[model samples]
Target: MLIGDVARRSGVSARMLRHYDTLGLVRPTGRTVGGYREYSAEDVRRIFHVESLRSLGLSLKQIGRALEDPAFTPSALVSDLIRQTEKRLAREKELLERLHAIDASTPTDWQEVLRIVELVRELDSPSAARRQQAVLARPEDVPVPAVLLAGAILTEPDTHVAGALRWALARSGGDGVATLRAGAHAEDAGIRRRAVLAIAEMPEAPGALEVLTHALGDLDTTVRRHAALALGRQGVAAAVPCLVSMVVEGCNDVDAAEVLGMLSLDPGCADRITTALVDELASPTADSATRIRLAQALVELAGATGQEVLRQLAHDDDGDVALVATALVGVLKERSLEDQADGHS
Candidate 1:
């Protein structure tokens, strides 16, 4: 076969076949009387072989070595090719993710597209300051995509950056709670905690309350405690038990006690919370330290219920408990007199 015929039969362009010949990758095996390049069957086979190897991402130089170098071992070259391909694949995947995020933003114009692109880039920046700035720079009216924000917040490890990201997500006014729910159920404990923290800040977001409720049962005490605190402030009675448990475990007990006191203002929760405190106080296994903390927590509860408990504890065997309760009783008495004086006036 002549060059044109070889190009036609093999589908390798004439120019490329000539280039291959020049590089000694596949040379013509013979020549006709007119001195045109002619390819024998074996030469055509070599051309096909070169094309096959090229399909595997082999460079022309590498293909030359592969076809002509008998001492060349493909195992090492093949391994290198695998590594290169994997790297390329990873880059492609990252590009695809960025594209998807940009597309999801639904930019109205080139400016919006650029803004979204810049935000995404900053969110993923290696510099923590840059990431923080990115979240803080978010416009109040233009919301970041919830899924993108969720992804960034879940992976953010820096304390400041994570907090900023959470604030940004909260302000997005989107259904970020559903996106965060994915992180809440993540296998990574850090991610789960981060997700709960972000959701805890979003009191008004749809489904946020439900997410916090579910988080109260998380195995990580930090998650449960944070959820309880947020829910407690939001007046969700579901947090009462967890708040009580935090007091028992001595984790954030003071804050828990304060929130519990606030919850007790509700007539419905007053009796139940008072009873829980009284039961814990009367537990035989509770040590003096536990009893002291519980005593202080009881001081947070207002009205006769808490005051009555204080009176009972005042006579207890533990001198410290008695001393603390005795002091609180005086404080409650002064406030009660002031209240009476104001009412009478």
Candidate 2:
């Protein structure tokens, strides 16, 4: 092992080991062609023994003498180590007993701890989607709501879970999409939130967009956020006006960001979105970030007229909105117009 690894293992600094080498207490067994020192397993054993002796209040000089092959009998060293180890074991056993007593008296929350450990294990397990699906299939064994929520959470970190989430989501609607919509109307907020999250993962799932919009209008923030996230995944510009209207008219900053994410995929649809943002930009209801995100979304969607529209928007009262608009203008201006827009068109 190298000096650092040895130092860390033996509780001796690498510098001290080099000093030990100078005193002939321990020396590297060999050197590389480039002259780097190397130690063998034998050297490690010797160094560790020296460190053990030093910790028990022996001087380095005394440790060196004790470590020398001829200076001390092997039986003497073995006996000393056995005595030290027994004392250490006695102290450790006392601590462990005290810990066990406290655990028994305090009512261990091992159930919660086990649940968390399982959750972490689920995250690390291969075929996690399948594992979640297996969990979701048995409502009698696993709480349906927790299993459903777990499946939804899995879909975000893993694409493989998308299919599993869709399976659970199908159970939400008779088809999953329809069920999620029904859940949105359910008296239980957890049902609605989980439903929204599940539906959002499968953007192309039938009736997903409509359910998401309905959820956005729901009195729940989490549902609205999931709706926005779903729309972004859907990448359908037809939903832009609805998103913009929600942002300009709604109170949540988070929802606006989600809708803007939708714009990233359809950069050709900006002009349609700009009309909506411009109307909202003048309103007291719209915030700077909201307006800017909408403007950026527009530029991304309307790559054709994005640059020109952005330049025109630069002088807008909403400074952040104008900045994003201008940046989009720069991106659109550099593209090859002939390649993207043919003369026949």
Candidate 3:
């Protein structure tokens, strides 16, 4: 419904909605492309709940929590809202009963309210850090362009506050996301970490491969880890050789296995990867348990090719790799016989 329609139907004014926004009372489900508030049926239901409590003189905070969560059927959430509303309503009722006496006994204290309004002027009103200081300078005054600045953060990454999106390549989102394909070489560790996560979260683009390729040789282990993971998820054959190196070079077990699984699934490219992993299974690092675990992950890639890898794995110096390799080889023999029987069908 339109804000005007909601105002007529629910008896909540348009101005109150802005106040509610500051108090975190309610929010529109969405805004129209033309920039108008849009509410869904579920939003209307939450609004009605807020309206009922407010009519009983409940504070905005009391209604805000209940309106935010829907799984609030249990006591801890709903009962608390009801209790706050009842307590505030009782205080308001007493004020109504003593209205005449209170008015006669006390002069209105505009001084305290004005003092509070003056004190608030020193604290920042949130915008980008550049604008927050300006807003706080005059709290009673409307912060010029604060609303426009907020909308820019969503539409333009450059306008973002000090969070994930701000570091995005200037104003373009994917440009920043694509920045981390090359691992941290000269870049600061924190900057490279932030850039790597940003790019990995975004969908791959044609230019992203070069970045991913460059990252494979990065001096930093973690930046290389994220780059390997992204290449594996992208599942392009161009990444197989690099992923193999990552498995061979990486210290982190889970990431190596993830790259191996994705490498195996890269259609028609499976044979080369399986053959290499089989060769590595026996002679992988003597000092590390990660090698054996990586070999088992290779076995998953091997399937029938598992026999070759298992032979190497059985001879592995690591006791756990030898045991797991022997057991998997036995399982493969049974499966092979079953396949032979099914072939006659």
* lDDT (Cα, tens digit) per residue for candidate 3, span 203-319: 354455666656666677676666777777777565565566566664555566666776676546678777666555446353345465556567557345646767777776677
Whole-model lDDT per candidate: 0.87, 0.61, 0.56
Assess every candidate by TM-score: 0.76, 0.40, 0.42
User: Which predicted model would earn the best lDDT?
Assistant: 1
A best-first ranking of the candidates according to their TM-score comes to 1, 3, 2
Model 3 spans > 4 angstroms off: 1-186, 245-250, 282-285, 288-290, 315-318, 330-345
Q: Best by TM-score, which number?
A: 1
User: Tens-digit lDDT track for model 2 on 7-43?
Assistant: 8887888899899889988998977787767889999
Query: Which structure is stronger by TM-score: 2 or 3?
Result: 3
Error of 1 at 290 (Å): 2.5
lDDT-better candidate, 2 vs 3: 2
C-alpha lDDT (0 to 100) for residue 292 of candidate 3: 57
